[model samples]
Target: MPLITIIGAGPGLGLEIARAFGQKGFDVALVARDQSKLDALAQTLAGEGIHAQGFTADVSVPATITNALQSIRETLGPIDVLEFSPADRTLESVDALKVTMENLQPQIDFYLGGAVTAVGAVLPDMIESNTGTILVTTGGGSLAPTPARGNINIAAAGLRNWTLNLNSALADTGVYVALVAITALIGGGRPDAEPAVIAKEYVKLHAERRDAELHYVAYDR
Candidate 1:
């Protein structure tokens, strides 16, 4: 079976993505900061007949992410798909004028830095094997920025830019890269924005190996 490693795996979209890929014969490796929550999610997937294992890592700490990916490789074999979507639980939004190096740095570290670390860890193997899929998730603010979430927008935009550029860089190679920008409140009463619905897009991106980005917008922004 192929392997998919989901960074920032949680109860929402992460779980659904695990299900979508797991059902398709991909063994799931879930990475998160909370061991208990990760265990619960793995158990849930197991109940659904989807083989999943959880690894704990804090995205803000690059070393932890590197360690977790190494563990995944040792345990599940080389990863076929890498999905990165870690949540920022502590950072609070600051207006554009209030943004500073102190405030913006953490967001950058959490989103952009984390992505670089995770990709760097597994990208070598993917390139050597000549087959892999990389999917990155960011909020709509990355594409359509608002002054209200200036720091977050800046960080997410950096991630988006990198993902697009990576896609172009790997065009000649078998590895595929794409960014997923969620523009609505997931599971916020919109059937179209539900986790399961949005997750299908991830699977499609991996299977088709086309498109550099997907904007999953459920409402007018």
Candidate 2:
């Protein structure tokens, strides 16, 4: 059976992806900071008699992620799909943006450390197994450079490009690196943007798993 690990299990995207895979008979492992949330989700899936397990971890911490993935492998076998759902803010809005060199540095550091560490911990396993997927949820932060929000953008773009480069280098090795980015409000398209419709599109992007460095899932206006 194929095993999948979702690192950032949001109620919508995270849960939806898990549900999709579960429906397809994949042994899904839900990973997040909140054990209760994963528990509730696992319970719901169990009601459907889906084989699911909830694992908790702070993906930002390499050790936590390393141990967590090891446990999942032990229980469900090697991970076939590694999904990074960002327990922290994948999207940083302008309203909450505080432009400070000191404050922003930490955020940048976190993103870089988080991405590299998470990928590092799992890449080896994927290579050894000879076939696996690492899916990172990139957000609008990767679109462009920002004055206040540039830090996250910088980090995401760095991860995306670095990942693509790695993928190119490893093409003969049989491992794939991909990014799923949410460009607009995931729910709806303005007053006209229906949340359900937008979500479907977002889901499609992940399902497609395009080789593009970053896939911007946006609603048509």
Candidate 3:
């Protein structure tokens, strides 16, 4: 079975995504900061007859992420699909005038730096094998930035552009890269943002090898 490594795996959307691919017979490598949470998630998947293992790592730390990927490769074989989700999602409105480097740096490191580390680790193998898929979960703020959340928007935008550029560089190499731009409040108890519903879109993205982007809205326009 193919392995799917989900970085920043946690509750809600992450778990749902795990279940979605796991049910499809994909061995899952769940990476998160909390060992207990990862173990619990793995046990739950095991109960459902889905193969899953947990690896603890801090996404912002490149060495930690690299180590986790190495351990995962030794345990679960090479990863076929990589799903990256930023662990820090706290949104604080910052004044455009007051936005200092200190305020913006955290988000940049968490989103952009973390993505570079995670993707770089597995990309070599994918390139050598000539097959792989990278799916990043980004917020709509990245596509349509607002001054109200300038820090997050700026960082997210950088990550989105990075993914697009990576995809361009890897074009025609049998590796597919895509983004799921979520415009809705995920796991906010709304129908459209439902974890299971949103997860299906991810599965579809992987199976169909669709375009480079998907805008997932939480409510009807």
Candidate 4:
């Protein structure tokens, strides 16, 4: 069975994607900094008969993520798909705009550096096998500039461009890279932006293996 590693697995889109991929017959490796949460999620997936394991790692640390991925490979198998998601949004409000540069750096590191580390951990194996998938979850802020979410926008924009370039370079190698840009709130703030609905787009990205980017936006206005 193929393996999918989800970095920053949580209660929202992360869990949704895990379940979505799990339904498609993919063994899952959930990576996050919290072991207890991971255990709970793993248990939940287990109840559904999905083979899932959790690995704890702070995405800001490359060594931790690399070691975790290595452990996952040893226990489950080589990762066929890697899902990159941010653990939290650092600059969440425009009113709280007095944040210093130091605080902002971690957000960039989490989004841009974290993806680089995770991909680097698995890309070599994917290259050797000449087949794999990389899916990045980004926000519409990356597409359109937003002063309120500057941190996320900057980091996500970097990741978005990086994924596109990586896709171009890996096109002939059979390693597909794609980005899912969420244009609205994920959990039904908008009619079409439901988590379940977004999860399908991820499944389609893996199955179709054609598109390099998907914009998931929902509005009821």
TM-score of every model versus the real structure: 0.98, 0.83, 0.95, 0.93
lDDT of candidates 1 onward, in order: 0.94, 0.70, 0.89, 0.86
TM-score result, candidate 3: 0.95
Per residue, candidate 2 scores C-alpha lDDT tens digits across 1-221 of 88778887767667777777776677889888888988998887788877788888886567887888888988888898887757366545332255456555555556657777777888898898787777777766665554555656666677677767776877777777766665666655453233344334434544665564555556565
Between prediction 1 and prediction 2, the one with superior TM-score is 1
Query: Best by lDDT, which number?
Result: 1
State which candidate, 3 or 4, has the greater lDDT: 3
lDDT pick, better of 1 and 4: 1
> Compared with the true structure, what per-residue lDDT tens digits does model 4 show for residues 128-221?
9999999998888778777777656777789899999999999999899999888877785765777777888999999999998988778886
Clashing residue pairs found in predicted model 1: none
Lowest summed-lDDT stretch of 10 residues in model 2?
191-200
Task: Give the lDDT of residue 21 in candidate 1.
Answer: 97
| Cand. 4 TM to true fold | 0.93
- What is the alpha-carbon lDDT for the whole of candidate 1? 0.94
Model 2 RMSD in angstroms: 3.4
Mark the regions of model 2 whose C-alpha exceeds 4 Å error after superposition. Answer: 87-101, 145-148, 189-210
Model 4 clash pairs?
A: none
Q: Which runs in model 1 stand beyond 4 Å of their true positions?
A: none
